[model samples]
Target chain A: GAGVSQTPSNKVTEKGKYVELRCDPISGHTALYWYRQSLGQGPEFLIYFQGTGAADDSGLPNDRFFAVRPEGSVSTLKIQRTERGDSAVYLCASSDGQRETQYFGPGTRLLVL
Target chain B: AQSVTQLDSHVSVSEGTPVLLRCNYSSSYSPSLFWYVQHPNKGLQLLLKYTSAATLVKGINGFEAEFKKSETSFHLTKPSAHMSDAAEYFCVVSLRSNDYKLSFGAGTTVTVRA
Candidate 1:
């Protein structure tokens, strides 16, 4: 009965550092997604996984943003050489499948200084 | 290529008054539409969704939306506003051809007054 969950609800990092945000999808969910929401803006898709493999990662802004879902139940979004411009909320969501309604987690607020 | 637009940046209504939030979407093919609500410090919650089965879709907490293909609109409506309804609302669209990736609007902030 648990919903999607994200760890460390808030993360403050310095520029040029590395960070990893974790997401634990709902039990039995096969599809997972990651998005970023800038202040005063809607969330934008970053990547999606339909099991252990990433089905799409075109939304990743650059090579610095990468994600992995090795076991299909949990996913980690990794960022390298973070910049102040990367300060935003990183959201995670999961669904039964691609066509199903996606449920969201509370999100990790990343503040890069 | 697909996008969603929420017409109003903010809407304020007295409690018990009718509420309306307008949204429009553009897509190259048939799309799945949804409305999501996010209260302060809370996760996004699905209010309702329309996947092309019915033009009028009913959602939780006395809310509903009608999908109008002719006008490219999917406006949310509630008969009466409540204090608990004050929050941020987003209009989202996803395309089957594009692997159901959601494209969200900027969002509408609603304020309810007693």
Candidate 2:
């Protein structure tokens, strides 16, 4: 059984740039979530998707952050006009839609310089 | 609103000694609680969870946690510490009404000494 996988284990970009992080959930998972972790802090929720729809986006910090999961499996987290404050480890997790334990990915560490 | 707190920022135990990491949670209703461990540069791993099935839940690597409703606490414990157990442990809580959106604590860093 393959766990959640995130691409670009590490990404470095300049401020005001745009970046997209990808996530591949388990084969049959219908729920996906994104979170951000800053240094010396725990992960903060971002967005969540159920099937192909965004079930909850309230955790998203601002309009600049958007996420999509088309066809109910793969997801992408997009950040627009990234700021230095946006630098952190972006984590993706998936669950079986039964409100069970979430399986997390290795995460993509983004550095906005 | 549901939230969790790891009472200790860090905990250190010698090999073969007991280990305890305290965690407290607050929720308007019955909540699902979980403990996760994360090694450096690694992803979060589910240590154990309490889904109302059992008050005393056991997890991998000889870890266990007891859920105390009277105290609103779910503290992780292990009979003996292992060097490989050194990592950051996060206490998480999720509410059924909130689509199970998880709320994580600041985390407790455990250091197992030899």
Candidate 3:
């Protein structure tokens, strides 16, 4: 079975720029989640989607961070006005349903200079 | 609020020796517990999970975990540590609801010495 996959394994962008990280969930998965892992720290929750709507976005840091899963199979995490502090690994995961075990993607390493 | 604590930040064990990684969780309700391992420069991988059905859960790579409600602990153990077991291990807790949120611990780095 194919696992969750994230595109642009590594991304480098200047501050104040916009970048989009893409995630392709496993086939038949209805739940997707996004998280960020800083250096020497565990992953922190960001946002989650069930079907085509975001079930929870409370973990999102601010308005500059946004995510969308339009068709439910793929998702895109958009960051506006990126900051140097945003330099971290952005990870995506997908599950068959809510409350189920999540399968994670390799992640996209974002670097803001 | 739900939270997880990995008592040890790092654990060093020799190959062929027993390995133990302690984790304690706090939750208002009966929570779902999981063990995930991440190798260097790799994504998180699910090792095992406890969803109230069983107390002793077995996972891949000869790894296992025991969920103790009396102590609010879920400790991962391996009978014999292998050199490949060197990685960062995380303990996560999620409320048993439709919410897709997970509380992660600081993680314990296992260093298996040969």
Can you write out model 2's per-residue Cα lDDT over B41-103, one digit (the tens) per residue?
889999999989989999999999999999999999999999999999999998877745889
Cα deviation at A57, candidate 3, in Å, is 0.9
The 10-residue segment of model 1 chain A with minimum total lDDT is A95-104
lDDT of 3 by residue, B1-114 (tens): 899999999999999999999999999998999999999877799999999987999999999999999999999999999999999999999888734788889999999999
Off by over 4 Å in 1: none
Q: What are the per-residue Cα lDDT tens digits for candidate 1 across B1-114?
A: 899999999999999999999999999999989999999988899999998898999999999999999999999999999999999999999997875589999999999999
* Candidate 3 or 2, higher TM-score: 2
lDDT of every predicted structure (CA atoms): 0.95, 0.93, 0.94
- The complex in candidate 3 yields a DockQ of 0.76
Off by over 4 Å in 3: none
RMSD of each: 0.7, 1.0, 1.1
Residue range with the least summed lDDT across 10 consecutive positions in model 2 chain A: A94-103
DockQ for each candidate? 0.82, 0.74, 0.76
Candidate 2 per-residue lDDT over residues A1-113, each given as its tens digit: 88899999999999999999999999998889999999888898898888999988999999999999888999999999999999999999999884767899999999999
**Candidate 2 clashing pairs?**
none
Better of 1 and 3 by lDDT: 1
